[model samples]
Target: MSRVQCPRCLRPKTHCLCPLIPRLDSRTRILLLQHPSEVNHALNTARLAALGLNNAELIVGEVFDDLPKLLNCPGYQARLLFPAEDAQPLQAYSSAPDEQPLLLVVPDGTWRKARKLLHLNPLLAALPRVTLAAGAVSRYRLRKAPGPGALSTVEAIVQALQTLEAPTSFEPLLKPFEALIDGQIEAMGEEVFQRNHGEGKA
Candidate 1:
């Protein structure tokens, strides 16, 4: 049987999440440097993030040759969002090379894949890096984070933007993400899904 795809989200019909996606605009433009492996992942949140944001750009590749061109074209302060131990907290920085609009370049993939992106892209690594505040956790129930403080790509982007952009909550941006989780739970049956996730009393 040929697998039918959802036109909006480009996912299989049984797991189509386009209906839950919301169009959002942000001054801090989002640049998702997604690993080729994740572009089509069934449960990917990075795709949702890119589609939901008005100023977001999704670039798929492991090692990119156009990093200089993309960054120069944006004319914004491009910053890398990752959890590397050396990444500085956004709050700690009070300045930049100039007062240009911010462009958040996020690496979307597994921890290892994300690391490879940074390593392969020297320009990305050289850019300033920001990490989520301590204790931020992932509400992405569909996947297990690789380590403590790990969050889904979309969650990190929203939280980082919330912190830097001065919003009491950018949480509404995550409602569709939550709905995606809920849809999966509904399909898998709440009790069974919860049991597997070790949530509540089984």
Candidate 2:
């Protein structure tokens, strides 16, 4: 089988239709601590989210040896955007007053991979967990969730930031995600039509 490069990003891209990623400045800083394995995935939205925000940083690794240093950075409050049983929703923490900007750290990977990162990295676990509201669909169609309401890293970030009353610039960042989803649907529809008409044959 021949691999087709994505017409947009020019990468051997998957059908992930997220649009031209936008870059916006936000008061809440976003730090996406992604697993190395997630970087190459065509559907990875963390990369797209990072492209949309000026204060966002996407770091790839299995461990964070410099966790303390990152936490100590000036004008930043570090919090992990993970949904734990005991964790509070992002809105609760977002309303808290602080002179510093909020640093939202999200782990991007499968359930097993994310769990491994959390387990192997004690520093990450030390941070307070921020959860989102229950009952949301995942934007990623390629991966199956271990359970319901498991959101992709990008969706989690957007939801969390919205709770914080993040700047209006964030709206632009969401456009790419919409574009991507729409594009994927269109592509899939075309494929289905072609197949039904026997035009997809070699």
Find the candidate with the highest lDDT and give its number: 1
lDDT (tens digit, per residue) of candidate 2 on 1-202: 8577665443456643334666566788888888999977756778878867788888889988887777675787788888788787766334456656678888899878888889989988878887887887765553455577787777777777777764443556566666666665576796664564333343
Candidate 2 — which residues are off by over 4 angstroms? 1-19, 92-99, 141-145, 166-169, 185-202
**Candidate 1 lDDT by residue in tens digits, 48-143:** 888888989898999999989888755678778876678878752245656666788899988789889988988888888877788888897766
- Name model 1 segments beyond 4 Å from true: 92-98, 200-202
lDDT score for residue 155 of model 1? 90
**TM-scores, all models, native as reference:** 0.86, 0.76
Model 2: lDDT equals: 0.72
lDDT against the true structure, per candidate, is 0.80, 0.72
